[model samples]
Target: MEMIVSFILAIVSYMLIDNVVLSRFYGICSFIGVGNKVKSAFSMGLAVTFVIMMATLVCYPLYFYVLVPAGIPFLDTLVYILVIASLVQIVGLFIKKTSPSLYKTLGIYLPLITTNCAVLGVVQTNSDSQLDFLTSLANGLGTSIGFLVVIVLFACMRERLNGYNIPKAMKGVPIALIVAALMAMAFMGFGGMVG
Candidate 1:
């Protein structure tokens, strides 16, 4: 029962308190750039979630059993980049083949997932913390869900704000940045819940 509770707590804490974009500030580039349209943002969120989960699935065991045992833990980051690049290629190809429009909409950001800090952050965090496979997987899922929530909500807010009249200085990126900051602060309020 304690193990089950821990697993659940991991998910809740990450999703609410330590959100990948809003709290930890990982993946902010894509979070801001591709977050203007709800449909596109939703697609990006799902893609990211898939990559994080799949990468965690592969990286956890590979790092603990292989890298650490070989006494080559320093190569972990390089290995992780390779794995992430390969996964991004796979995702890009699949998206291009199945949904040409979304592929076009995502454009550079799709491939940018290879370098996206959030994707790399979760995988590296798992290894750095030496979390067991199940716990690491739970962490990945939590972060992914948090990413989805923030991006989708941000996109929705942007969509709504588009119709409103705004001052010259506070329009466009300025407004978006303000909204994101407010969101970060709001998510920070949940810190007490987990800690």
Candidate 2:
């Protein structure tokens, strides 16, 4: 019962209160860069989510069952990065094969997922904290979904911002950053709910 409750709490907390983008500020690169178009943002989100989840699936077991026992846990960061890079390549190939337009739209960002700190952070946090397998899985899934939600919403907001008459100084990245700060605050308000 306690484990189930912890799982549910982990999902909700990470998805909202402990958001990877807004609160943790891990994947701001894609959040601002690809968040201009709704379609592209959604695509990026899905891509990121896939990479994070897959990385978690492989990383958790590999770390606990393999790395720790091998007495070389210090190599975790390098190992995780390599794993993420491989997953990003797979996703890039799949996306390119199925949707060339999206592949082109995502362009460098597609491959950049390998460097996305959010993916690396979640995987590292799971291992560093020594969470059980199920809890670690929950944390990874929740954080990825949080990334998806925030990116899509930011994209939607940016799409609508075009209709508004904005000051010259507050245009482009400036306004986006302001909006993200506001979002971070709103998401942070939920933090006390979980803890």
Candidate 3:
């Protein structure tokens, strides 16, 4: 029971309070750019989630067993970047071969995941905290789910916003920014729940 409760809390904290996109503001590039359509936003979210999980899986073990033991923890950032970059390449190739349309739809955003701070942030946090493997996996999964939830909701809102009348100055990216700010504020409500 205790472990189950802890798991539930972890999910809630990550999904609502520590949301990578909304709360931490990581991965905003693709968050804003690919969020105009629901399909694309979901695809981006899933891709990001997969990359985060894979990176965490590889980075955590490498950091603990290799870097720490070798007394070269300083190389963590570079190593993590390389690992994430390589994983993104594999994901990209898979997408290209399996679903060319999604590949085109994702376009630059797919590659951008390599540089996305959110992905690196997850791996770095896991390594720095020295979380056990299962906990690290949970954190990565929770963070990705949070990313997916926000992007999907944001995309839906953007789709609806497209049909509304608005001040000329607030059209396009301006309104989108405003909407994102509002969403961020709404997410702040969950802060107290975690604490």
Considering summed lDDT, which 10 consecutive residues are worst modelled in model 3? 102-111
| Ten residues in sequence with the least summed lDDT for candidate 1 | 103-112
For residue 142, model 3's alpha carbon misses the true position, in angstroms, by 0.9
How high is the lDDT of residue 22 in model 2?
87
Tens digit per residue, CA lDDT, model 2, 69-141: 9999999999999988988888788888898877776666777788788999999999999989888889888
Which lDDT values do the candidates have, in the order given? 0.88, 0.88, 0.87
Clashing pairs in 1: none
Q: Per-candidate TM vs. native?
A: 0.90, 0.90, 0.90
Clashes of each: 0, 0, 0
Question: For model 3, how does the per-residue alpha-carbon lDDT over 73-185 read when each residue is reduced to its tens digit?
Answer: 99999999999998999888898899878888765677889878889988888888878787788789889999999999999999998778899988888888889999999
For model 2, the local distance difference test gives: 0.88
Model 3 gets an lDDT of 0.87
